[model samples]
Target: MFETLPNARRCAVLIAASLAAMGGAAPAFGQAAGQTAMPDSKAGAAKPKLWDARPASPNATINLVHLLVKQGVLTEDQAAGLIKQADDEAYIARQAAKAASTRADEAAKAANAAAAASEPKGTRHVTYVPEIVKRQLREDIKREVMAKAEQENWASPGKYPEWAQRIRFYGDIRGRYQGSFFPTGNDQFDALHFNAVNTGSPYDMASPYNLPTYNTTQNRNQIKLRARLGMEADLTSGFNAGIRIATGESNSPVSTNQTMGGGGSNFSKFGLWLDRGYLTYQAWDRNLVASVGRFDNPFWSPTDLVWHRDLGFDGFAVQGRYAVSDSFTPFGVLGAFPIFNTDFNAGTNLAQLDSKFASRDKWVFGGQVGFSSRFDSYRELRLAAAFYDFENVQGQASQPCYVQSSSDICNTDQTRPLFAQKGNTYMLLRNLQVGSWNNFGTTSLYQYYGLLQQFRPMTVSASLDLGDFHPYHIVLDGEFVWNTAFNRGLAAAGTGLPASVGITSPGVALNNRAASSDGKTVGPFNGGDKGWMARVTVGKKEIRQLGDWSVHAGYKYLESDATVDAFVDSDFGLGGTNLKGYFLGGSYGLSPNVWASLRWLSANNIGGVPYAVDVVLVDLNAKF
Candidate 1:
C-alpha cells in the first residue's frame, strides 16, 4: 500500500516493535526449545490483585494483599509470611491468604470468648401483636399500595412503579423488502415492513434507509415482523424505570440481530441491542419527579434518532406538573448527567478508545424544561426547551463553538473513501460483531479531533394537534449545541469551493472549513449554527381496520454544529458539506400489522461544501 504520513512522528509502530517496547512490562517465563511459557501470578498469603483483560501476558496482577490487610480481613504479618512462602515456589504468593485466614480466625474467636465472658448481661420484656391482627394489617397494607398505583395509571404518561419491576421493553419491528429505482446495497431489492397498503407505499418513508449510497436498491424489500418491545416499571412507584428493546433502525443498548455497521460491505455481524434504561421517582405522588440514568434528552423530534444521543450515564433529574386551572396542566423537567457510562453496544468497537467517555475524561452537564396543554376543543399542544454543556471542548470554525474533536471530518467512507487508513481495517473487526442497531451507523462518532473531553447542548421543540385539522399535527423542532471549546486543527475557511447541497459528509477538511469563523446563522443574525426542522402530517382514522394513511412533508436546515453524532454521505456522486434536504413521503394501511409507502428525497446546497443526491425508495413491512 502506498501512503503519505501526515506526521511521521505520530505513526503507530508495528505489532512486533510495539511488543518489544513493552520489555520488562511483559516478561516471558522462559521459552524452552520449540516451547511456550505461561506466566502465573505469585501464590502466598497475599490476596489476588485486580485483573485487566487487555494485553494478556505474565505479571498482570496489581497486588491485592495490602487491600485485604487494610480492610482487617487479614493481618500484615500473616499475609507477608504466606506471600513469602509462595514466592519460594515460582512467585504464586496469592494462595497463601487462605492459610493465614485460618490462623487469624482462631485467634480472634478465642479473644471474643474471653471478652464476652467478662462482660455484663441485660434483659427486656417483649410483646408481639396477635397473629390475627398482624395478618389483617399486612393485607390492608397490600390493598393500599395497589390502590395507589392504580390511581396514577389513570393519567396519560402516568407516574407508576412496581417494587419487583424497574425496566420496560418497547420497540417496533419491520417485516418487509425494499425495491429501488437504482441498482444498489441489497440483493433482493425489497422485502416487507410491518404494515402497508399495497406494493407502492411504506410505513416509515421518512427514515434515512439507504443513506449515502442510495443507488443500492438491495434493501428495498424488508419485513416488519416484530416492531418493538417496551418495558416500564417503577423501581418504587414515585420512582419509575423505562426501556425499549428491539431489532429496528432505532438505536439499542446493544443489538443481537446483526452487525449494524454499513450492513453490506459483504459483512455478516448480527446481535441484540437495548435502547434506554431510565429510573426516576416522584417526590409527592403527582407533584415532582426525580430520575437518574440514560434517558430522552427532552428535545422532541419525529426523526426517531436524536442528536446528542449518547445512551449511558449516572444522572440526577427532576420534573414537576402543576395545573393552573381546570383545563391546563403545565409540566417541566430538569436533569444533569455525568459522562461515565457502562451499557455497551451489542458488538465491540474498532478503536480501543471507542467508549462514550474516554478514560479520565472530564464531564459537563445537560438539562431541559417542557410543557403541554389541552384546550376545550380536545386539541393538545406542547413546548420544550433544553441545553447541553460540552465543557472544555470547542470548534475552530462557524458558530465559533467548542467541539472536542473534528468529528465532522474523520467520518468513515460511508459513501466512498479518498484514501485508506489503518483505522479502516480496524473497523472491519468490529463490523463482524452482532446486535447493533440504528438505521445509519454501526457505531456513532462523537469526537473527531480526539481532544474533546465533554459536550454541552441546548434544545427547543413544539408540537400541536389541531382538532379541526382532520387528525393533523404540526411539529417544529430545533436544537443548538455549543462546544464550550472548539479546537480542531484545520483551515478556518474555504477559498475555492463551489456551492453544494445535501452531502451528508465531505470529510474533515471540507466539513470543518465550511463553518467559517465568520458568524452566520439561519433567517437572522447569521442565525445560530444549531439545527432547525419543521414537519406536518395530516391523516384520517384507520380505513377498514388497517390504519391511518397520511401524506407527510417537511423542511430542515442543519448548520455544521456536529453535536448530532449521526451523519450520512452522498449516494448521488458529488459530495461536500453537512446535510440539508426535503423529505416527501407517506404511509398507507394494508392489514393491521402490514403497510407500505414510497418517498422521493432531494438535496442541493449543504454546509457551503458542494455535494448532491436524489433518492426514491418504496417499502413494505409486516409484523405479528
Candidate 2:
C-alpha cells in the first residue's frame, strides 16, 4: 500500500512502519486508514511547525534517515552528525556512574576508620586464639614445613645419621692464671706433710702425728686450664644418657683444673678424666628421675660451701619434685655414694689367719628435702635440710705395721697409714707417746689405733633471689653444717677408754671407741662441730656482651670436721676444713659465649695461728 501511495503519504507510512519495528508506538497523523490521501507538510505554503518538522520517534527517525542516506535520498554528512551526538551522551553516562561508585567506596572506608578509633582498649574486636589452638597451629606449621623439606630433599640425604637429631653436645674451656701468697705462717697445723721425709727417708710418710717442718714465707704462681666436653642423648622409654670428659686427674674428686707448664716443660699435654657417665630414667611426668653410674653431684648447694662443684659421685640417686601449686614446689633427693673400696687379700700368706680381715666398703647415705616457692616471676626462695651419714669413713685398726720391718712393730708416729688429711683437725686415736723419741731404736713396740670417729653431718641451706632490680639480681644464700662426729673426736681426745678397741677392721667400722693409755672409760661430749657460710651476689642474670657484669662476695667459716676435708674447695686456704675466709669475685662478659672472671680469696686458720693465705685467680672462659 505504501508503494501505491503518494510521496508524502508513503513517507508517513514508512515512518510509522519503522517505529513499529523498533517497538515504539507512532503518534496519530490524523489520516484515516481507508483514505489514501495524507497531508503534505513539506509542500505547504506556510513553513512546517517545529513539532511537525521533528521526527515521530527519535530511534526510528534515525534509522529511517540512515535508510534514506543508503538509498541516496540524504547525504553522508547528515547521517554522521546524528551518530556523533548519540556517542557523546553514552560516554557522559559512563563517567557519571564511575564517579558515584568512587564516592561510595570513600565513605565506607571513613566509617570503618572512625569505628576503629572509637573502640576502647581490651575490647574484643578480634577473634581470640586460645593457647591450645595456638599450640596446634605451631605444631601443624612445623610438620608441614618438615614434610615439604623431606619431599624436596632440602636436608642432607645420607650425610648424617638419623640418631644425630636426638643428640645434644655442649662444652666449655677455661684458661686461668692463679697466684698463692702466704706470709708469716706461724705454727699452723701442718697437714701438707712438708716436714716429713719421703725421698731421703727409708719409708713412705703415711703418718698424721708428725710435727710441722717449720712455717716460713711462701709465694707461688701458676697457670691452669679446665676444659670439659659433654654430650646427652635421648633414649627409649623416657630415658636419657649423658657423658662428660674433663681435664683433671682421676683421683682428684674436688678439682677439675689441670695446671699448665708441668712435667718439667713449658707446655705439656694434659690428660682427660671421665667426669661423668650416667643413665637417667624419667617418670611421673618427668618430675622424678632416677640416675645410676658416675654422675654430677646430686646435692643442691648454692655455693661451694659444703660441696664443690667439680665433685662427682659414683652412685645412684633418685630426685623428685611435686608442684603443689603454680609457685610452690616441694622436692626431695636421695642418694648413696661409694667413698672407699676395701680389698681383702687372699689366704696365701701364712701369717694371717683368715682372708676376710676387714668387712665392707665405705659408703655415704644422704638425702635432702626442700621446698621451693616463687612469689612471682620476680622473686623466689629455696630452703633445704639434709642429713649425710658416712659408714666406715674412718679406718678401723689397732695396729698399723709395715711388712718391710723384721719384727712385728708399729710404724713410726710419722709414717703410719691414716686417713688423708687436708687441714682438718685429726685427733690421734692411738697413744704415740712411746714413739716420741726421734730415734727409732729407743721406741717401744705397741699396737696402733685407727681413726675413732664417723661423720654424720646435718646441714641446712637457703637461698633467696630478687630478680631484675633494674639490671641486676640480688641473690643471697647461706649454709650451716653441724658435724655430729666432730664433737665425738674431740671428746675422745681428752677421754680415757672404752670397753673395747672398737671393731677390728680396715675401713669397716662405724662405732668410734677410744681408750687412753691409763685405761679409764670417759663420756662423749665436747665442742668444735659447726660450720657456716654466707654469700651475697648482685649482678646481671647473664652476660650477653660487653658492659655486662656481675659481682659476688662470700664469707665461709668451716670447722675442723664439718665436712670432709678432701671435698672442700681446693683453692681456698690451699684447700680444706678448719679455714675461715673471705672471697670476692667479679665477672665480665666479653661476648655472648665468652667471659672473664677474677676471684680473690683471703683466708686464715680458724685456730688463730697467724697463718694467712691469699689466693688470686683470673680466668677466661668460653662456652659452646
Candidate 3:
C-alpha cells in the first residue's frame, strides 16, 4: 500500500512517524486505538481535527501517517517505506531554496549598481567634522576621564594621597626694619624689669645696684622677621581642625616678631612656637560654632586696645550668629581662657618637703554680643559690647616670715604675677619679720611685688564703613573701655605716699610721688580706669593686587589699670599701658599676596613721667 502512494504522501508519513516515535498524540489517534472517545453530540461541536488545525505543510501529511501508525491502522513495514520517500523529497526542497536565494542576492546587487550610476561623477558622501568639533569631543572625553580619576584617587598614583584632598595650607612672612628713638631726660632707673624679677628668684633689696631695670633712654635700631605657617583640614561630620607655627624670640602672647640677632647675636636660628591649635564644630548649618584647644580670639573688637591680634586663647569658645534679615546679623561669643595654671607642686621648701599652695589659677571669662547692619550695598556699621572678667589674677600679700637663709620660701610668694609689662600699680608681695634682714646686711627686705588693681573691663566698640566711593572708601573705627574693678584708694596707697613707700611703682616713681611744700605727696597715683582709641582708614581695605593701597591714622589713650598690660598691643610705646600715642601707617601692594607698609608711632607717658619715644617701621610682607 505504501508503494502505491505518491512521494509527497510518503514524505509526510515519515515525518508523522518520527513525531509519533517522539511521543506526540492526538484525540483521533486515541479513539482509533480503542481509547474512550467523546459522544457524537459533543464531537459535532468540537474544534477542527488536529490535522486540520495545522497549516497546509509537509508536517501535516506526516501527521496523517503518524496517526495511522499510532492507531495500528498501518504496519511498521509501511511506515518505514514512507520515511525513505520523505527523505528524498526533503533533499529536492533544499536545492530549490538555494537557487532562489542566489537569484534574490543578484537582484539586490543590480539595484545598488543603478543607484550608484545616478550620482554625479567624483562626488562622495563624507562627514567632514570641523577641527573645533573634534577638539570639543576630545576635551569632553578627557574631562570625563579626569573626573573619574579624581573620584577614584588614581590620577597620579603615589603623588598625592586621598586624604590630602581635604587639607589646605597657608602661610605668611614679614620682614621689618624698625628704629626706636628715645628723647633725652627720660627716667632710666625707675622702670623696673618686673617680668624678669618675678620669673626668677626674688631680688635682694640690700644690693640696690643689682636690681633689674628696663632700658629707658636708649635709642636703638633693629631688623625683625615674622613667619607663620598653618594648615586646616576638613574632618568628618562638620568638624574642622587647624594648627599653626610661628617664629618668635620667646613665647610671648602679644608678639610673634623675632628681633634679628637679639638673643646672643651669633647668627643663631630663630625658635618656632605653637601659635594656634584648635578644633571646631559647625552645628546647625554654621549658625553656631564651638571650638576647643588654643584658638583665635572669639570676640570682635575694633582695635587692639584690650586684646592683641596675635594672642591665642587657651580654652573653649562658642560663637553664634543669626541672620534676622539680609541687612542685619546679630552675633554673640562666649569664652573661657586659662591665663595661667598653678604647678602641681607649687611650693617646695629647702628641707625637701612639699607644702602645696592653694590653686591660684588665673582665668579670663569673657562674652560679647553685637549686631552688624548694612544700610546699603556700600555702607555698613557694626557695634558690640563686651565684658571680660579676670579671675584670681590679683595678688595677695604673704604672712610675715623669718628669712634665716636665701633658700627660705615665702608662703604667698606664688601670688606674684608670672608675667607683666609695666603700667600697673604694684605692692610688695612678702612681708618679712623685723629682724629677718640681719643676715642680708640691710633693713630693706628681699621680696617680690604684685599688681594692686584687678582687671575686669567693660568695652564698647564701633566701626563705620563708608564705601559709597567703592574700593576707595573710608572706614572709621573706635573703642572705649573702662575697668570696673579698679579702686582709687588701693592704687593711690600702693604707690603714692611716702608712708606707703614699700610699693614698687612703674615708670618714673620719684616724679609720680612728688613731695609737696608741706611734705605731702601729690601725683597721678589715682590710677585711671578708662581707655579709648579711634582710627580712620582711607582707600582699599585689603591689598589684593598690584597698585592697591591703604592708609590709616589712629590715636590711642590707655591709662594704667584700664586693661591687662600683658595683653594689649605690643608695638605701641613698645607695649603696656599708662601711655598716649598717635600712629600713622600705609600699605601698598607690590603684587598679588605681597605688600609693603610703613608706620610711624610717637608715644609719651600719659602721667607720672615725661618719657617719650618715637618709632618708625618699614615692612615687606608676603603670603601664600
Candidate 4:
C-alpha cells in the first residue's frame, strides 16, 4: 500500500524531504508561500462543522455531494448512505401520502360496491355540483358576513333621541335684506298697529341737503342671529329636563326688559321671543309623558315656523296625553305668556297681553283634544280652538304720536289703544290642516291689508278633514276678527303715527290741510268688522329636515269696498308693509354644510305702482 501510495502525496512527501534536506521540513498539506492546501479528510470533517453555513438550495447541496465523491473524500456508496439519511424525513412523508391515497381508493371502492348492491327500485338518485354554484355560495356567504359586521359596527345613540335622555341640539339663524319703492322713503309699516317709521321717503329728492340723485330706491340690509339649545340627561331612569333661551328668530336672546322692538335702545331684535322649555317624565314607559314649563302649543301652521326645525318662544305650558277611552286617548295643551309678538317694525311692540280671566297678568289659553282611530281611518283627527287673550293694563298700551296725514290716532291729543277694543283683545282661531281635526266645519282663508282691507280682524274660524273623498288631504278653514276699537292710550300719548292710521287718517291734502280716522272698514259681512277672505294652497307641507338655510314666500288678497263713507281724506296706501303680491323663493345647499338662499318680493304702492326687490344671502355653520 505504501509503494502504491498516490503520486501527489508521494510527491508532496518528497518535496517536504527535499525541503528538510535543504533546511527544515514543512507540515503535511502545507503549500508553499504560507498557504494551506487542505486534505480531503479535513475538508470533509470541516464541512459537517460548516453545517450552519451549508448551501440552502437543493442544486447547491447536490453539487457539494458530487464534489466530495469526485475528490476521494467519500466513496459513492458512502455518499449514497448520507443522501438516503438526509431524505429520511421526505421518505416518511411520501409513505404517509401514498398510504392515505390507497385508503381513499379503498374507501371509494367499498362505497361503490355498497351502492351497487343496494340499488333501489324504480327511483333515480342524482348528485352533482358545478364549480359556478360553489363560487356563488362563497360570494353570498362573504357578503352576508360583511353586511353583518357593518351593521354591528355603526349603531350608535344620536343626540336628541326622544328616549335615553340624550343631548338635544337646537339652533337657528335668520337674515333679510330690504329694498323698497314707495312714493316717499320716510314711511314705516307695523301691521299690528297702524303706524309708519318715517314721514316721507328718506330718499325724497324734494327735501333739503340739496342732492340731485334721488330715485325712490330704499336699499337696506339686515342680519338676524338666533340660537336654541336643549339637553335632557337621565338623572335617574324615567325623568328628564331641557331648556332654551327665549329670544327673537332674527335677534340675540340678550333682549331688554323695558321697551321691546326693532333697532335703537330697545331690547328685542327680529322679534322672535322665547317660546318653549320643559321637564318630562316617563314612569309609564314614556308613552305617557307629562311636561310643564315653556312649551309650544301643538297647533299646525306655516307661520308658527316650528316645523322647519328652528323657531320657538318662552312661556309656561303644560301638555300631556290621557287615555280616556279605547277609541280615544285625548291630548291637551295649556300655555301662558305675558305677551305675544305683533310683527311690527321694531320695539318689543305688544301684539296682545291679557290673562284668561282678565287679570294684571298676560296669558294665552288653548288646547286640542284628539282621539286615535284604526289604520282604515289613517289617524285620529282633532278639533281645537285657541285664543291669545288681550287686555288693557291701565296706561299700558300702544299709541301713535305723529301723523303722515294717514293715521287714525294722529294730529289730535285724542288718545286710544289700537291693540284693543272696549276692554278685550285676543285671537279666536282654529287649526285647519287636514289630518289635524276630528268633527269640524270647512273654513276658507284669504288675507287682506292696507286701504280697503286695513286691519280687517281675523274671522273666528273652524275646520275639518273629509275622510278620503279628497285623499290628498283636503281641509276647510274659516276665521274672522271682530269688536274693533282704537288704542285711546296711544292717541293721548302723542307718539308719532304712520299714515293711514296716524294724524294722516284723514290724509293731508298736499299740505297740513286734512286729517281724520274715518277710513273704510273690513267690509262685506255682518255689522261686526265686516268682509271675509278665502284662500287655498296645494302641496304645502310642514315637518321637514331642518337646515341652517331655508326660505319661504306667500301671497294674500283682501275683499273690501273701494268706496268708503268713513273719512274724506281716506286713501289706503297698499305699498310697503301691506304685502299683496304672490312670491316664491328658495335656498340651495352648496357644500354639505354651507348653504345659500334668494328671495323676490312684490307689492303695490300707494301710487299704484308695483314694487319689487330681490334678496340673496349665504350662510356657513359649524357644530360640536
Candidate 5:
C-alpha cells in the first residue's frame, strides 16, 4: 500500500517518521491541533482533547491522521481509516469540479444557437468589411432607388396620361414700343381711306370736304403686343395636325399686333383670331406634302416683297421636293387661294326687288419652282421663280344707271375691291345718266372707286449664305417683281371722263400725271409696274442661347401696281405698296428663349403725293 501511494503522500509519511525519531513535538497545522491537553484535579481524571469539526485539506488531513497515531490518540486501524476517508473526499471534490466545467460549455453553445435563430432570413453575418466595399455598396443602392422612383413616378404617381406623350406645345409672346415720325411736308388729305369708303356708304363726290383720309402729318407713338399659342398632334402614318391662335386688333391678314390701349379701352378684353389651322399629309418618303386649310406660305420667298410675313393662305397647297444629291435639292409649290367670295344675296336694294348681281368670286393661282445648291457644308445658294395669276379681280364699268334716289343700286357695284390700301390706280364704278335730281341740293350719284389695272405678278427671288464663320453667317438676299397684266391704254379708257355726272378731279389716282379734273382727255398714265428688294445680314440665323446676337440692313422699292397693296409688308410705309425704304435692325438674346430687338425704318412714297415716314421699334420677345 505504501509503494502504491503518490509522491506527495510518500513525502508526508517520511516527514512524520523523522519527526517521531527526533522526539520533537508535532507542529500545529491549524486551530484543530493548537489546543494543549489539560488534567482535572478534583476528579483526578483526564479530559478528551477537542478537534475541529470541518473537513480538512488533503495534505493537512494526512498529516493530522499520522500525528494522532504517534500520540496514541488513535489506534493504527483507525488512523488508516481516517487516511482513506481523506482520500475519498478529495476524489469526490475533483468529480464536482469536472461537472461544473461541462455545464458552462453547454450553456455557451445554447446561447449561440438562440442568437442565430433570432436573425432575419438571408442575412449575411459579416463581422468585418473593408471601407472601399462599403462605399461602393452605398452608391449602388442609391442608383437603384433613383431608377425605380423615376420609372414609377414616385413623386406624383400616374400624373401623366398616355395620350399626352404624343402631343407637343409651343408659343411665343412679344411686346413692342413703336414711334412713327412723319415728316412736316406730307400730304395728309391725298392719302385716301379706300377701305372705309368702299365698305361703308359711298363717299359724296360733290362734297370732298368730309372725305376720310390717313394721318400722314401727325406723329404717333404706341405700345403693341403679339401673342401666339399653338400645338401639334401626331396622328401617325405621316399625318399631322396643328392649330394656332393669336392676338389682333382686328381680323387683318397682314398683321397680328394689337394696340395696347385701343378697342374701347377701360381694360376691355382683346380679340383672339385663328392664325393657323391645318392638316398635312406627307408621302413618298416625306418628299411630298399636301395641306388643306389656313396654313403658312408654301413658297420659299427670300423677302416679304409680294407677301407679308404674317399672312396665311386659306386654300389647298401641295409642296414637293427631291434631293438629287448631297449638294443639291429641288422643290416646287402649287396653290390656289380665294381672295373674296361674293355674297349669296348680292343686291340689297329694296327699290329693285329682283335685281341680283352676277357672281364675281375672286381667286389667285400661284406656282413656284426653286432649287438649293450647297457649295459646301458652310455655303449655300437658293434661287426661285414664281407666277401668280389673279382671276376675276378686275373692275368693269357699269351700264347706264338712273340713280334718282339713294335706294337705286348699280349693276356693277360688286366690281369694286373689297379691301384696298394706298398706291393703286382707281376709276369710278357708276356711270350715271342725266336726271332732274342731280340739279337739286344733293348730288344724285353717290359713287365708289375700283382698281383700274389688272394684276398678274411674276417674281424671282435669290439668297446666298456665306458661312465661313461657323454658327454665324453673312446672308445676301434679292427679289424682283413685275406685274405682267398692267395695260396703260385699258386703264385710261376705264376711267369715265366728261360723261360722268359728278364733275370731279381724278379720284385717288396712284400717279399725278392725269390731266383734267373731270377726266376728259386721257393723259399718259406713267404707272409703275416693277418692284425690287435687296438685303444683307451678318448674324446667327436664330437667337436661342444667351449672348447670341444678329444684325441686318435692307432696302425695299415696291411700285404702285407691282403687287397687291393689301398683301405687301405692313411695317414699311405704314402698310402699303408704292414705297421705297431702308431698314436697319439688330437683335440680342437676353437669356434662353428670350431676346430683345431694335429696328429703324425710313420710307417714302415711290410715286404720288409727297409722303415719308420714319419708324423706330423696340421689342422684347419670349418663347416656350
Candidate 6:
C-alpha cells in the first residue's frame, strides 16, 4: 500500500517514527497546515490517536485511511467516518464551481443580447466602393429628380430638357358678354347749342324749343374676347426676363377687349399687341428689383378707382422692400414712363416752314412710399402714398390748324391733335397763340385749342385683410386721389365778361369754346380737384382649386378731378371720372386655374346732366 501511494508512504513513515519514540503511546504530532493535532493519549491508552496519522494532502490522507481499513489495522466505522467527511467537502466545492459557471454564462448572454439590440435594422452590409464613385451616384440621383417642378412638353418624358427646365410658360384667356344700357332722353345728348355762324362769338343761348326728331340714346350689347400669352425665363442668379402678348389694338392704352362685331359681323381677326416685355434684376439679396421695358404699373393700386388695370407703362421702374422683422416691411417704388414721343427731323434753314415745328414728348414720372405689416398669420395691412406728375401733356384748348390760302373759314377740317379723353376736363387756353399752327391771328375754336390739363395727382390707398374669417373673409380698402392741376382755378378777373357765366349755362357751351371770364384760361369741372373712395369686400380671398369661390361688392365715388381721366377705372361710369356707382362681382373656380365670373356696374353721372348707365358682364377666365 505504501509503494502504491508515495505521499501516503511518506506520511506513514513519519507517524511510525513518532509512535516508536513515544514508547508506543499516542504521540503529540505537530499540527498540519490547518488541522490541530489530537491531545496526546496516555502511554498505555486503549486506542491510538488516528488524527496523528492524518496527512496534509486530502487525497494522501484518504488513501492511507482506506489502506488501514483494508488491512484491518483500523476499524470500518472509523475509516468510513473520515471518508464521508472528505466526500461531503468535495461535493460542496463542486456545487460552488457549477454555480459560478452558470452566473458567468448568464452575464455573457446578456451582453450579447444588448449588442444585438443596439445595431440598426436589417443585415449589416459592408462594401469597398471608392469615395468618388459613391459621390457620383448621389449626384446622378439628384440630377435625375424633378419633383415639384414644372414639366413641359409631356409628350415624351422622364423630365424636361435641360434648357426647358429653366423656362416657364403661363397665360389666361377671357371671353366676355357685355351689355350696356344708356339713358333714353334726347335732352342728355342734344341739350347744348353750337354757334357755327358767328366768328369770335360766344355759344348760342338756345332754349329746348325744337326737340330732336329721334331718341338718340342707343343701348348696345356686344361680345368681346381677351387672350394673353406670357413667358418667363430664369437667366442667371438673380436676373430674369419676361414677355407677354395680348389681344388688343396697339396704342389703345385703356381697353384690351376686342369687340367681335365691329364691322357688320365679318369674321374679324384679333390684333395681338405687345403687352409686357421686361428685364428684371434683383439686388440687395433679392429685396430690391429694377425693371426696364414695357411693364406693369409699379404703383400700389388697391382699386381701379384711381388707376385702370390694363394700363401698362412703357419705361423703367425700380422697387425696393426691406424687412425690419418677421411681420413688418417697408417698400418704395419709382417709375418713369414715356406717354408719347414727338421728334421731327428738320434742317436749320427757315425756308421750310412746316419742318421746324414739333411738340415736346409727353412723360409721366411716379413715386410711391409705403409700409406693410402682418399682425399674425391671419391678418395683414398695407398702406401707401403715391404721386404722379405728367410732363408735356398740356396743350392749348383752341389748337386750330390753318392753311395760307384759305383764311376765311379757318379750315375746321385741319385741326391740331390734342390729347383729349373722357375723364379729363380738357382746358381751353382761349386765344393763346401757339407756333405749331399756321399764323391765324387768334380767333381759334375751342376744340382746336383743347389743351390736355397737366395733372399732378397725389394718392393715398390702404387695404386691411382679415384672414381669420375662414370661409368668409373680409377686406376693407380705401383710396383717395387729389389732382392738384385738374381743377385749376381760372384767373378770370381782367377780361370784360358777363357775371352769369356759370359752368352749366349756354355761355360755357359744349359745341364751341366756353370763354373764361378773363378770356385767358378756363377752369376744369366745377368741383375741386379731389376724389375719394371706400370699399369693402367680404368673400374668399382666392379661388385656387375646385369648389372654391370668391365674391365682392363695393361702391365708388370718382370725382372729375380726382385722377387723370385716361387712367381711372375704365369700367366705372363708362370709363370716366365724375361718376358714382356700385359694383358687385363673383367668381367660381372650375379647376385649380380655371374659373368664371360675373360683374355688374350701376353708375350715374355725379354732377352733370341726368345720365345713367348700367353695364353687365359675364366672363369665362382660365389660367395655366
Best by TM-score: 3
RMSD of 5: 22.4
Model 1 stretches with alpha carbons more than 4 Å out? 1-171, 176-227, 234-236, 242-244, 248-269, 297-316, 338-364, 392-457, 469-528, 540-545, 567-577, 591-597, 615-624
Q: What's model 2's TM-score?
A: 0.64
Per-residue lDDT tens digits for candidate 3, residues 464-517, read 999999888899999999999988767555343543343333212222332244
Q: What is the C-alpha RMSD of each candidate to the true structure, in Å?
A: 35.7, 19.9, 18.7, 26.5, 22.4, 19.7
Each candidate structure's TM-score, on Cα atoms with residue i matched to residue i, is 0.45, 0.64, 0.73, 0.37, 0.71, 0.63
lDDT of 6 by residue, 1-624 (tens): 555544434455654565467554322333233442333354235454554455544575566555444333456786677668667766887999989977976786787678678987884635355687689889887665533233443334576765677889988888999988876642344222221212133221222233221222678788888888999998888899999988864446778787887643578676788888999999899899999998888888888877788787789999999999999999999999987665464223447665354455678999999999999988999999999997766543323433222222222111222322353443223332334353333322222222334578899999999989777678998988887775343322212334233322211322212334463343233434677777777777777778778778888887655666667776776676767888898988888888889999998656434557889999988888
- Where model 5 places Cα greater than 4 Å from the true spot, the runs are 1-159, 348-354, 404-408, 440-442, 491-524
> Tens-digit lDDT track for model 4 on 494-569?
2233432232222111111112234222111111122222333222122132442334545433212211111101
Better of 4 and 6 by TM-score: 6
lDDT, candidate 1, residue 41?
Answer: 38
Please give the lDDT score at residue 238 for candidate 3: 88
**lDDT (Cα atoms) of all candidates against the true structure:** 0.40, 0.65, 0.78, 0.35, 0.78, 0.63
Ten-residue region with minimum lDDT total, candidate 4? 421-430
Each candidate's number of clashing pairs is 159, 3, 3, 82, 0, 8
Question: After best superposition, candidate 5 residue 146: deviation in angstroms?
Answer: 21
Q: Of 1 and 4, which scores higher on lDDT? A: 1
Off by over 4 Å in 2: 1-160, 188-216, 264-266, 344-348, 351-356, 399-421, 427-452, 468-471, 488-527, 608-610
Measure candidate 2: CA RMSD: 19.9
Clashing pairs in 2: 398-448, 399-448, 496-516
Lowest-lDDT window of 10 residues in candidate 1?
Answer: 421-430
Tell me the TM-score of model 5.
Answer: 0.71
Q: Summarize candidate 2's per-residue lDDT along 441-555 as a digit string, tens digits.
A: 2333223333335578899999999995847899999999988765443334433334232211222221122222353343232224688999998988787678789999999
Worst 10 residues of 5 by lDDT: 499-508
Ranking by TM-score: 3, 5, 2, 6, 1, 4
Pairs that collide in candidate 5 are none
Decide which is better by lDDT, 1 or 2: 2
